[model samples]
Target: MADIGAAIATRMDVLPITRTHRRATVAVGLGLFFEFYEVFLAGVLSSVLVKEFALSKAALPPLLASTFVGMFLGALLLGRLADRFGRRGAFLLNLGFYSVFSLLGAFSPNAVMLLVTRFFAGLGLGAEPPLADTYLTDLLPARHRGRFIALAYTLAFCGVPVVGFLAKGITEGKILGIPGWRWMFVLGALGAVVVFALRRGLPESPRWLQAVGRTEEADRVVAAFEAEAGITEQKPAAAAPVNEPAVPPRALLRPPYRRRTGMMVVFHLLQTFGYYGFGTLVPLVLTAKGYPVSQSLLFTAVTYLGYPLGSALSLPVVERFERKFLVIGTGLAMAVFGIAFGYSGSMALVLVFGFLYTATSNVFSNAFHIYQAEIFPTSVRSTAASGTYSLSRLATAAMPFVLVPLLEGAGPNWLFVTVAAAMVVVAVDVAALGPRTTGRALEAVNTDGAPVTAPERAPRQ
Candidate 1:
C-alpha cells in the first residue's frame, strides 16, 4: 500500500498541468493576494493611520509590530494543525480568521482596538502562506513545482499595485462617513471572504492523505485527478524505505533535518529585517525626504510596478534556475537595490531603486517560499515550514521598533546599509547550506539523495 501510494502521488505530479491544478492554484493564490494586499496596507495607510488615530510616532510602531506578533503565534501554534488535520481545513480556518478580524479592524473606534484586530488578523496571515505553499507543493510535480508556485505568488504580488492604486485614489475620503483607511480594510476583507468561499471545494492533498495511511482515499483523489486529465496511472516500482513512525515535531531537531531547520532559522530571521524593515518603512522614508503624503503615495504606487512584473518574468525560468542559486542571487540583488534606494536623492532614483528592489525581492520571495516547504517531508511539511516561517514573523514583529529608531538616528542610507548587510548574511547562509531541489523528485528531495517512498504509519489521532 505504501509503495502504490507513493507511485500514485508521483503520478499526480508528473501528469500534464490540468485545469484542476490551475483552478486550485488560482484559489490558493487569491487567498495570498488578499493577504499581501492587506499586509501592504501598512505602507498604503501610513499617513492615514497617523492622522486618523492621532497617533504619536511612538504609538505607531507598536501598532505596526502587533500584527507580526500575532503572525508569530499563528505560525508557531497553528502550523502543525495542517499536518495533523488537513491542508484544506487548515487553510479555510486561517483564511476565515484573517478575513473576519480584518473586517473587525475596520470598525475599530481607536488605534488600540485597531491594533488588537490587526494582531488577530496577523495570526491568520502568518499561518496561511507557508501552509498554502505546502498545499501547492504537495499537489505539483517536481518539474513544474517551482514555476506554478512562482506564478501563483505572482498573482499575489499583483495586489501590491492594487493596494497602492486604491490607497492613492482614496487618500482623502469619507466613504459611508468612515475614513479611507477603514474602507481599505473593508475592501481587503471582502476580497478574502470571496476567496474563502471559492476555496471550499478544493480537494485535500493526495500525498497528505497517503502519508496518513488512508490509501483508499488517496487513490480516490488521484483517480479524480486522472479522470480530469484523461490519463492512466503507470505501474509503480518496488517499495522504498521511509521512517514509519509519525515522529514528533521534535524529530525535526534530530540529525538529518536539524541542519535544514537551522539553515531556515538563520535565513528567515535575518531576511525579515531586510524585507519587511525596508518595505514597510518605504512610505515613511519618502515622507522624511520631504514629499507630501499625496506625492509619497503616488511614488510608492509607481515603485510597486516591479512586484508583479518581476514575479511574472521569473516564471519561464523558475524550473530552469536552481532554486538555491536563485535564492542566493535574488537575495544579493535585493541588498544592492535596497542600498541604492536608501541613497536616492531624487524621486526618480527612489522610484528606480524601489522598483528594482521590489522585483528582485519578489524573485527571492517566490524562490524561498517554495524552497522552505520543499525541504521537509509530508508528515511535517507545513509544521516545519510554519515553524521556521515564524522566525520572519517574529523578526518583522520587531522590525518597526528596530528600524524606525535607526532611520531616525542614522538616516535612510545607513538604515539601508543595515538592511543590505542582513541580506548579505542570508545569501551566504543559502549558498552554504540550502538544499538543491530543482527538477528533483519529491521523494529524492525528502531523503536528500536517497530513494523517496511513503512510509507506513499508524493512524494519527
Candidate 2:
C-alpha cells in the first residue's frame, strides 16, 4: 500500500484553491488580526495610560517588556506543543488563552495589573504567529503558497490600521462609559472568540495527521476536501516515503539546518529592534516633537493607512519575486525610510517617511513570515520556527528597555540610527545566507525528502 506522506503531497500539492481553503486561510487570519491589533495597541495604550495615570518612564518599559517576557516564554516552551499536539487544537488553545486574558486586562486596577494581564495574554500571542505560519505552510499548495500566504497576512495586517481607527474612536468617545484603552482589549477579546468558533470547522492538516500515525484520518481529510471541490481522487505521488523521522530541536543545529537556523535567529533579533522599536514609539515620537495629542494620533492613524495597502501591493508580486530577495529589498527600504523619519523635523517629512517605513516593512513582513516557516520539514517545523521566532519577541521585549533610554538620552535621530543599523545587519545576513525558496516544494527546499516539484501543466485526476 502507498504511504501517507505521498498521499498528502499528491492531495495537497496540486489541488486547486477551493472555497474551504479560502475559508481556512481567512479563519486563521482573522484570529491573527486581533493578535496584531493587540500588539499595536501597546503604542496607543501607552499614550492613554501615560496621560490618564501619569505612567513613569521606568514603569513604561517594564509594562511594555512584560508582554514579550510572557511571549518569549510561550514561544520557547510552546514551540513543541503544536508539534506534539495537533495544529488545529494547539492554535485554538493559543487563541482561547489570549482571548480570555485580553478581556481580563480591561478590568485591571493599575498598570501593574495591566502589565500582568498583558503578559499573560502575550503568552498566546507569541506562540500564535509561528503556529499559524507553520500550519499554513504545511497545508498550503506549494505552487500557489506565496500568493495565498501573502493574502492571509494582508488580511491579518489590515488589523493594524483597523486598530488604529478603533483607538482613535475610543479616545474620542467612550462606549458604555468605559475608557477607550480598555475597550481596545475588549474588542480584541471578542473578535478572537468569534474567530475560534469559525475555525472549529477547519480540517486538521493531512501531513500532521500522517506524522502522528493517523494516516487513515489524513486520508479522510484529503478525501473530504476533494469531495467538496469535486476533484477526483488521484494516485499518490510515487516518490518520497510516507513519513520522515522527527528531529529533536537541538538536531536542527547539527548540519544543513544549522546555517538556516542561525540566519533566522539573527534575522529575528535584528529586525525586531528595528520594527517594534519604531512601531511602539510612534505616539511617543510625535509627542516628543511637541505635536498636540489629537494631532499626533491623527497623524499616527494617517501613517498607519499604509499597513494594509502595502500588503495588498505586495500581493500581485509575492509569487513573482524570490522571497529572500523580496525580504532583503523591502527590509533595506524600511531602514532607509525609518532613518529618514527619525531625522525629519517637519510634520510633512515625518508622515511621508513613516508611511514609507510602514508600507515597506509590511511587504517585508509578509514575505519573511512565509519564508521562515517554509525552510523546515514537517516533523520539527513548528519547534524550529517558533524557537527561532521567539528570539524576535524577546528582542522586541527588550526594545522598549533599549529604545526608551536611547530616545531620552540621545534623541530620535540616534535612536533610529540604532534601529536602522540593526535592520541593515538583518538585510545583509539574509542576502548573504538566505536560501532560494521561490517556486520550490517545501520538501525539495529543505533537502529531507524526495523532490516533488509541480509540473508546469496542472495534473488531471
Clashing pairs in 2: none
lDDT for each residue of candidate 1 in 1-461, tens digit (9 for 90 to 100): 76676676666655667787898899988988987886788767878889988999899899988888999999987788999998999889888899899999989999989999999999887887898889999898667788999988999999989888888997688787877778888888888889989889999998888888887898898878777776654443344433323456888999788989999999999999777777788888998889999998888888888889988878977788888999999999888999899989988898989999998888888988889998888889999999999989899978888998988888988999999999999999988877788876666777645654332221111
Clashing pairs in 1: none
Provide the TM-score for each candidate, comma-separated: 0.95, 0.95
What lDDT would candidate 2 get against the real structure? Answer: 0.82
> What is the TM-score (0 to 1) of candidate 1?
0.95
lDDT of 2 by residue, 405-441 (tens): 8888888888888888988899999998888787777
Scored against the true structure, residue 396 in model 1 reaches a CA lDDT of 90
Residues forming the 10-long window of minimal summed lDDT in candidate 1: 452-461
